[model samples]
Target: MKFSRRASANWKGTGADGSGSISTQTGALDKAPYSTKARFEDGKGTNPEELVGAAHAGCFTMKLSFVIAEMGFTPGNIDTKAKVTFEDGKITNIHLDLSATVDGMSEEDFQKAAKDAKENCPISVLLNTDITMDAKLV
Candidate 1:
């Protein structure tokens, strides 16, 4: 199977003075604004790292759902947060925090599913940075 996603950005002016807007094919980000200040300073709008974190969190959560289901349990709720760290103009780490509720499942099993999701998710597989996860059954 194959799938494709697209996003576009348009910028004008210097790196420190320029501004741009980003949009995705799905319109999830319809011409969302971004700039050097937005990325490096406390400015409005979204940044690249924020977008990556969102993608990672979404992918890992979905993968965890499948992993839990395969283990013969129905998941109640899964909340995941992917924190992307950027330093020295490079992405340093991604930390995934997952909290889940599953009926009749042990904490050990839930951790296993979360770990499996972190290891097998498409975004996790594609990223080259350090990825760690803290999973809890709640």
Candidate 2:
């Protein structure tokens, strides 16, 4: 199976002085603003790193739920946070912090499932940077 998603960005002026708006096909981020200040310094609006973090966190959490179900455990309240580190004009690393509640699952089993999901999630596979994770079964 295959799927495609689309997003668009519009920018004006030079890289340092320019500003842009990003829109997604799903309308979730219709003309959302982005700028150099937002990306490299404290400013309003969103940036690529923030969006990547959100996507990674959401993808990993969902994948973990599925992995738990596949392992014959019921998953609950899975929460994940992804930190994308950008350095020297490149994405250096991504760190995923996960906490989840599952019924009748051991710490070792949950760790294994989280590791599998972190390694196999679409975003994890798509990123061409180091990915690390810390998982806790709560």
For model 2, residues 4-118, the per-residue Cα lDDT tens digits are 9999999998999899999999999999999999999998989999999999999999999999999999997899989999999999999998989998999999999999999
Q: What TM-score, over all chains together, does every model reach?
A: 0.97, 0.97
Where is model 2 more than 4 Å wrong at Cα? none
Number of clashing pairs per prediction, in order: 0, 0
Estimate the TM-score for candidate 2. Answer: 0.97
lDDT per residue, candidate 1, 15-105, as tens digits?
Answer: 8999999999999899999998889889998899999999999999999999999999999999999899999998899999888899999
Off by over 4 Å in 1: none
**Per-prediction CA RMSD (Å):** 0.8, 0.8
In model 2, pairs of residues that clash are none
